[model samples]
Target: MALVELGRFNRNEAHILIGRLDSEGVVAIPFDGEASIGDGSYLFIAVRVLVDEDDLATAKAIVESAA
Candidate 1:
């Protein structure tokens, strides 16, 4: 399945969002969470939260409701 970005957040937030999505039965993943770590600036990079393209709509709704 094609993965589409749902949003970008800090590493902790990204993982939290992934857990929320998973609880709702949507498979989600975090990308680039460790990028820039060589310089200890990983937190400066926004981690991407992605979900299956087919679940994008549902995922969006869930996230919006959480906000």
Candidate 2:
């Protein structure tokens, strides 16, 4: 399955979004989340939220609605 970036968020925000998507049956993963741990500058780094390309539209709608 091809993955596409749905949005960029901080680590915590990414987790929240992941949970939100999960509730809607959309599988999303946060990239760079681990790498940002312990540096204490994680908030400065943008975490990438990715989902299957086929689910892009639905995921986008979910994220937009949350916003």
Candidate 3:
């Protein structure tokens, strides 16, 4: 499946955005949102928006104004 990243949101913001998408019936998930640690380690507490290929434009548009 093709995935597009919409925005890099803080943990709370991401959840709110996810709630918005969920309401709109768009299939979305949170991806990598974090600070990297030493030795290729990633610490993800926040969430990055991920959507299907077809949802890229819409998702980008939605989050564009969200920031």
**Candidate 2 Cα outliers beyond 4 Å, as residue runs:** none
Candidate that beats the other on lDDT, 2 or 3, i.e. the better one: 2
Which ten contiguous residues of candidate 1 have the minimum total lDDT?
9-18
Q: Could you give candidate 3's per-residue lDDT for residues 1-67 as a string of tens digits?
A: 7988776777778878988887877778887644553545454445778889998877777767665
Which clashing pairs does model 1 show?
none
Q: Give the lDDT of residue 47 in candidate 3.
A: 71
Model 3 per-residue lDDT at 60: 71
**Which residue pairs does candidate 2 place in steric collision?**
none
| Local accuracy of candidate 1 as per-residue lDDT tens digits, 19-62 | 99999999998899988999999999999999999999999999
How would you encode candidate 2's per-residue C-alpha lDDT over 1-67 as one tens digit per residue? 9999998898789999999999999999889877766978767888999999999999999988987
- Each model's lDDT: 0.94, 0.90, 0.74
Off by over 4 Å in 1: none
lDDT top scorer: 1
Query: In model 1, what lDDT does residue 1 have?
Result: 100
